[model samples]
Target: MTTSPESSGGATQSHKPACPTAEMGRWPASWEQEMQSTVNYLWHTDDLLGQGATASVYKARNKKSGELVAVKVFNTASYLRPREVQVREFEVLRKLNHQNIIKLFAVEEMGGSRQKVLVMEYCASGSLMSVLEGPENAFGLPEDEFLVVLRCVVAGMNHLRENGIVHRDIKPGNIMRLVGEEGQSIYKLTDFGAARELDDDEKFVSVYGTEEYLHPDMYERAVLRKPQQKAFGVAVDLWSIGVTLYHAATGSLPFVPFGGPRRNKEIMYRITTEKPAGAIAGTQRLENGPLEWSYTLPVTCQLSMGLQSQLVPILANILEVEQAKCWGFDQFFAETSDILQRVVVHVFSLPQAVVHHVYIHAHNTIAIFLEAVYKQTNVAPQHQEYLFEGHLCVLEPSLSAQHIAHTTASSPLTLFSMVSETPKGLAFRDPALDIPKFVPKVDLQADYNTAKGVLGAGYQALRLAQALLAGQELMLRGLHWFVFSNMAGVTEIQELKRAAELRSKLRTLAEVLSRCSRNITETKMTLSNLSSELMKNRDQVHEDRSIQQIQCCLDKMYLIYKQFKKSRMRPGLGYNEEQIHKLDKVNFSHLAKRLLQVFQEERVQKYQASLVTHGKRMRVVHETRNHLRLVGCSVAACNTEAQGAQESLSKILDWLSHQLLQDRTKGAQASPPPTAPYPSPALKDLVLHMQELCKEMKVLASDLQDNNRVIEGLSRVPSAPDI
Candidate 1:
């Protein structure tokens, strides 16, 4: 049946009425009144929807519901058609309830003529054939539109196969398109007039399908009227689906012999039956010209290669003339299901017309899609904001690519590559360095407060570490002066040699402190940028998992603070030697007096005053610890490294007190020096201990540098969205 170009339901329409009128052969004039009175359905006689060989469809309205429906009225000749065929269509439609299949409303009878009419759900967008006939779609349907058609048809056919039925006629004309409430295009299979119960492996002798889409075996006996023994199985529908898919993809039949498929049926059948393996299509321009063959879709096709790679294999397997070679409905359904589960998204970065076609599974989240987009455009994931149908595409685990594709597949998703602003106190260098600027902000205020507390504690620990580093350097400088400036108050030859050895030891310790200081400076610079980066992008963490991660980081920071406090060296830069004196056989009276005189000297007193200033400076730095703002796991790492530096400083102070300084508080005056050679057994033991501390400090500096490298690596980690 044919219907209005603007309004197509069960059938299509044209200028003249497709049904039998008074001029041809009309039913009674009162039949319309009888139909309205008996069935409560008013048929618009002027609005002919479509006309087929035995029926005419019209636009009709139900009086009780006031809902528009398509009315398929069988002509007088249809009454003489097979009773089994008529009953089968009604039964099939009544049992079917799928979104991809046309819906049947009611079967009403006309009182005057006693004629039956089918009322089905009306589709305003008409048939797919009409859409493909449009000038813009002359080449083929657009890729998205083609995918919709392909998926819907496969779903409808799969539903039929599940119910042990086969739609002998599958074509674009038998499929209808409707605009959904959300403006999404939906395709539904209609006109199941040729459908019948036929399971796999079951055979039927009848041949009933459009010639262009018919299998060669069916074409031979049906069109040529040739004697044939082979019966058609359920696989016949696969042949029709292949033709429909090819037509929707390229706007032409896959096999067209010379003079077109309609005029040269014998040649078209030969072309389809004689195709070699892997051959996909055949074309001929003239009756006598050589036929051209193609193994894949032409370059003019709009579909992406990713889609064609999956779709073409299904076409090749099902287009086979031999039923044994053709795929079963299960394989066909599985292949189509895979295709439906994957979507090709066209992403266009704003201000540039170039489009990136990204392929992703329908189940993937927006975050995953953004990562793929970043790979294509080199835009940082955190700097990308995508808009689909004018709504921001945010990270939500429940929302997936399928949902977006369902709602807004007509237009490319617009990607706005946001330029991140520079964080305060940090100058921008390379754009690539700003990749991980987006850090998840703590959701709970209590957690945030706890984070700040940990940062304050860490800042205090770093200050203590710095103070210890300063003291260690001061002690090294003081020891250097004492060892080389003839202030040791020793006269023995062995004592002079021991002093030279001590001077060399002091130089080595000084070099270790220098390296440690460099490590501290570099770490501080790294933390400054890391803290600013985190503060600049305080995107809220909505997910419970992300919140837990933030809490875990805070807990680790508190642990590091505790460890730093526990490992802190005791204050005063001197140790109690009462235990050592009890064990020593020699008296230290002479050494103690010499140390006191040296400390009181003007040159040594200047170094002593500098030490007191450093102690006060540490106190002031600690007072301002709470004012410092540091965030992220990187700060926690800094605290850990500071703990190592403090240990190193403690070792340096221990060596200074053990090997060089005397306890001046033990003031027993003018006792004889040790009778044994200078730097007795205890002093030699202290020197060896100092050498070990130097080696440990080198390792500590190396570890601090390694930790700094770890923090730098964190800047490159992509910040995952809070889904």
Candidate 2:
């Protein structure tokens, strides 16, 4: 219905991408069926996203993982009538899995509803067109940032082309970006609603593209025909890409604003017959062709000539009046990729033969190249300063990219280095360069000791020349200590020897352990048994036992033990043993009785006192158990309260269910007045079925039947059958 700085260029012969033969109505393999159920349950109310003539979108989150998603809902009555729903985007995006393309997660049909829903990946950052023109972005993007947007756009467009899909609308609104977990911004192509699949046939004609970004052929040839049989190919998308880039790079559209009666005619005239009216000032690149639109490039007064040269050509191809040689992302890449790759630079150092053909990536920063120089020249990074044509290297700018477009191969760039006069600097200097004269002292013993002390870590910081020159003459005529170590080999040997010695010690220890192991197992088992018995007895004995009970138990124990002792001192042993017994003046039975009486009275009184403490502890435990039971009851009450809260979604879902069940078979086709519950039709059917089962449950109780011949809670429907 509206224009988007609409446009296209001339046609070029290339292989048209083939349409995937798969049908579009089904969900892609990436969708999880189980998630579909959760999605329906948790997505109670949808956050309205936007509305358009064809469909409305809403934001919803997965209840389980809380992952955000977008759902596109088709109009119910209109959907069921003529067009049903175009699931083209589902089919297209299902087949697509590119980082720059919006992902389609699932396809959903609500119960008895004519509307279909498409669940898609969510992009929090809205449309690029909005950001550029809306209040959020007070000013347009900077050139460097705009270039990033361009790269992502081209990548997305190229993906579409390769897949044999044309995103008929290539304006900024169609492009949106998502910020990743690592704070990386990724732009994605959305609203495949306007996209159409391409076949092997070279000519493709559609009148559905937005007016703002209409290709020239669509207006001049297609609009001119009787039925508007506009014939074009993927080149149409390329032209729109140009217009988008122009709008993105420059803060405004190229075509002049038009209104009143013949708006389309005025816009078409400006697109075909005339050049762009720069809302924002721009410089023209006149190298490509006489067509001013092709030469319509960004104002690059502050930009590098190389960048301009690379960009101007591609812009020329994209906006070319003739579709022939139209630049898609392929031509764009070919033009820009070269300057980003290998760069040729001449190196000039004072007092050394200058070298030509120094090759490095143009995209590399001066910092990175300097590091490489550090490796080769032995000059530290901090000490190295590079000069590019007398200017300090900055911006670490991309080299082989469009920057080289304006540059000629004949005027090769020269890189000059001014290294500080340190030891590392001397290493980078030509060996023939003069040095201050001094005697080189050689102390092999001291050097070897130092190397041994620190090289246990297996690192050596010695120059190759110094290592060899330590014992030999004719080395550097200077005095400087170069750290050298033999620990690399010594360290390896020490590790191996130590590992072997440990292994031998372990073997010897094992042999000694085996010799000492014979009685240990038996002793340990005996000790373990004794300890278990002692613990069991101690746990059973209550310090709270009554003193009288304890005394009775002790008396019984004494009687049993006394009889055993009496049996050992039997009368048969009187003659020989009686004399010895008499010699054992102590009365064993008497002594045991005296000791029991003395300790029992004192210890039993103390033990009985401890019983009062235990009784109090038992009372506390009993109270805690009672309190825990109450907490359990409280949790059950909370569950009932939560159930009450669940009624919130009931009214919403009930209304949705009513609309969904409405027979649209004979109704007038119009936009459905309201939306259904966010769940899929399958889930709704499940909930309804479960409800029906709940009503029929009283059949399990025979006595609960009603006198009216109805099964108590299983109240029959009034004239309708339960489904």
Candidate 3:
């Protein structure tokens, strides 16, 4: 035998044999030896285990500990840049620390080739897709066991959502089960290759995911009719969960039929536009029917029939074709929790279990429900008393009068007795003028006008002032509205002022309340900081033997606690005992008072502004009308002059309009047209213009009358406004 030059490290090195065996006969003796040498080289160098288009993975043992590790080696020369992958993978893995998630251990580079390797926690059980499709498939797991597996998946996904991460690609291939005891398994989610982190105010984008698990919005592109669409965040993960659960429960994907990739798109369309024929039918076949999908599946799997039913209605609310109907995270969380609770109860049938689930889920849903309730209940705190008290007053102001009469007829605060042994006053006859007996007729128009006038500008101003005073009341109310409305909490006073004309006054109220909320928030933050500082200085405090120093600290603590209590107290307008009791039943008085005060302050400021700016113009119109009448001008002639004058006055108004436009424009060069400066046409000018127009027509009429044919022609001329 002759040695091949490439063979090394004490391995067999043969070039050729005198008589070749069948295995060696097909190739040249030297080539066969080289092939063996290449295999030995790979075994020794640990450079390759599996190879792909851009990269290869190797099974390697740590040189120091001899522990087995999977190293993903990437070709830097290829399209997949190693640095980019390293950065993205690191960023993603650092934020995600779920048990179900694969852990990234370390990254290293080979010195000679500049080749990179990423070491990751290896799963011995392998990918979910392989297990499900292979000999050790979990497709036939017992119903209880299946549900347990499903729950693990859901818990992992829920953990992801809690941390604001979305595993966009949720499929069997990405999930791995870690075997525990007696074939029991805990599912681990792997492959963050397609994961995306949700921003504080972002919705889901990219519409990218596995075809089987794609949501209707992702594949079919139907207008997302759910409120969640507005800010499609973690809910996309939920949709994927639905697909996963459907597959787990039915042993087949709900949307995709028994066909290849070509049919997948069509199946998605059907799923989005048409309902699954019997998505829930098999659910009843389980040993325990219709498992609680919410708690069981991964964030992606919980999207089963039960969830769809609950979510569709909610999505309709959130993705309401009308944006207003769309629900925000708060609304979505609330509806989700409610449905989850109902489903849990429906499946488990045990109150204790249901309560436990409820408690576990409460943290997820409470703030949202509280916000919804707050939004629904938010009213002007000042007007709260008025709302309840005024209703009573409207119905019966005579209660106060009755008390006064009773007091006068007997001792103070006591009612008069009918059978008293007192002599009759004078002749005990009814007087001719029985003033108290007269009844006033109800005047509907007057009453409405009075109510409107009373609630005008002044009411708005009062409300604004009250909002400033009771900070927490405004903050809580605003928070409620923000949750319900999904608008940014107010940052400015102008936003509240502008809210006056919109149909939803809640938005405006929320804005004002938000402004005041800062005070309460800052106070709490200060208290927390102080307490933390004190705790840090615990040794110093103890070391101080001076009683005065300890007393000072105690005083500070007491003051903070008192402030906290005061901030937490619900503010309300004080009503009489009877009024308070009556209002308490309706729960309207507190809100009414707050609302009234806000409206009153706004109204007063507006009314004052209008008086200062527009009053003179109104007076001019009145004076003009009077002057036209005094001049004996016909209504038509006066009206024409008034119209001409009003139009001509635009020249004078231009300056004011330009100034206003400049104010609005800020740094911009262009100016808007002036309209405010041209006062409205006086009534006198209108009348005068009308008279002049009438005179011109009369002269033409007379000329036509003298000529019969001309008169007929003149009659045909269209009539103009009297001027």
**Which structure among the candidates has the greatest TM-score?**
1
Lowest lDDT 10-residue stretch of candidate 1: 485-494
User: Model 2: how far is 219 from its true place, Å?
Assistant: 3.8
TM-score of each: 0.52, 0.40, 0.33
**lDDT (Cα, tens digit) per residue for candidate 3, span 552-638:** 333343333333333334343234633533332223223333444433343333333322322232232223223322322222232
Those runs of model 1 whose alpha carbons end farther than 4 Å from true positions after fitting are 1-38, 63-66, 285-287, 342-676, 679-723
lDDT of 1 by residue, 220-272 (tens): 98777789899889988899899899989976689998767878877787788
State each model's CA lDDT, in order: 0.57, 0.43, 0.37
- Candidate 3 runs further than 4 Å off: 1-59, 75-86, 134-140, 181-183, 204-207, 220-232, 261-264, 276-723
Q: lDDT tens string, model 2, 579-643?
A: 54333222322433343343334333333332333233223323332332342343333334333
Give the top-scoring candidate (lDDT).
Answer: 1
- Report the error of model 3 at residue 77, Å: 8.6
Clashes of each: 13, 25, 84
